[model samples]
Target: MAKNKLEISYEIDFELVAINASVKEYKLAWMLNKSLAWNLVKRENIELDFTGNKALLISNYLYETEYQTFRLIRNRAVDGEEQFNAFIIPELKNFDYFIMLENESVGFDLNAFISKIKEIPFVQFAVLMDAAALKSKDNLIF
Candidate 1:
């Protein structure tokens, strides 16, 4: 008899932006909303359970349009016991937060969007991140 195997893969179809800022999550969201004319609202925290029963609750804010969905997530792990391995994207630990953009429509300029994020007074810098190249990309499923 032969055994069967199964594998599942998730598509990395979203645009990721790493933001380096010294402000709180709510304040950043509020600034982005005001500056970009977006309606980002606080949503449920993203709970990620790791090994050794450690769970990380990351703050999440969301905004949606007819052709796109945007999610703002904190990089640091909140309310988690894992000190060394705390970041949601461990490879990009220096970043303060991430903006995940799911663009369903064409003509979306990611660079232009990044420029807008950089215009925020509190934001030190913003850069495009390649989700497909991240080693810990699985953690971004939410």
Candidate 2:
């Protein structure tokens, strides 16, 4: 029997406060990119703000799989829209300190990935902004 395959679309918006509080965008991006890489969450997009003691990081991640359905559904429910509108939108339009990173992945574990990202030594606080899942129908056979 063939296993069922699903294309899962999801985004994880988070704020990562640097331990030093004065870290540069590139440095912060590097730290986050490495952490995301470890967790297998593709870094679809990344934005960094260093204006204050707690810098913000918004990252979008996606993956295609057949073995992880429950995890995907659960991850799609993390909320942070208000924060995105208030903080992310302005920076996105301004393009002031935002940096877009390469997207890559290895495995599927949404919750574990978030937890791993939070474990990074330099990251003071990491909060989930928002997450949602969408199933692709292009490959569906009737």
Candidate 3:
């Protein structure tokens, strides 16, 4: 008797973007998850993670006044003292926020998806980490 083995493969990629720390992670995630732009590329096959890093050397380049202004506006919004929309201005020099995207579908157009992501406000930089094709699957020797 002989048994048949099956293998499944996917093209996984990571998209890195620097977002403003003042922008809530959930809000950005929600925007990405709900946007038609993201959905067109197969919504169920992607995963997103947001992280913050205060130690990056780039942080040193930001002026003290900019950081203070950001905090002030963010605090006011959080405290319900202001009804203004929090705009993510990368020029303020805050790029501590990081967004990592894991794409699990082989047919997904990464370049197109990334371009759309960059359109979101406050995205200082958008880059594709390890552009090489990566395949994830179990090895089977016959």
* Candidate that scores best on TM-score: 1
lDDT of 2 by residue, 28-130 (tens): 5456557654222444343443445433344444332343211111111123542333234332232222222223234544456557646767645444322
Q: Give candidate 2's whole-model lDDT.
A: 0.34
Model 3 lDDT at residue 67: 16
Best by lDDT: 1
lDDT of 3 by residue, 48-134 (tens): 111342111111111022112110111111212322322122232344344444433466565876677677675555555342321
Q: Which parts of model 1 have CA positions greater than 4 angstroms off? A: 1-8, 80-85
Q: Candidate 2 at residue 126, lDDT?
A: 42
Against the hidden reference, what TM-scores do the models get? 0.89, 0.31, 0.35
Candidate 3: regions farther than 4 A off = 1-22, 36-103, 131-142
| Greater-TM-score candidate between 2 and 3 | 3
For candidate 1, the per-residue lDDT at 4 reads 93
| Candidate 1 global CA lDDT score | 0.89
Could you tell me which residue pairs clash in candidate 3?
A: none
Candidates in order have lDDT scores of: 0.89, 0.34, 0.34
Using TM-score as the yardstick, the better of models 1 and 2 is: 1
| N/CA/C clash count, model 1 | 0
Of 1 and 3, which scores higher on TM-score? 1
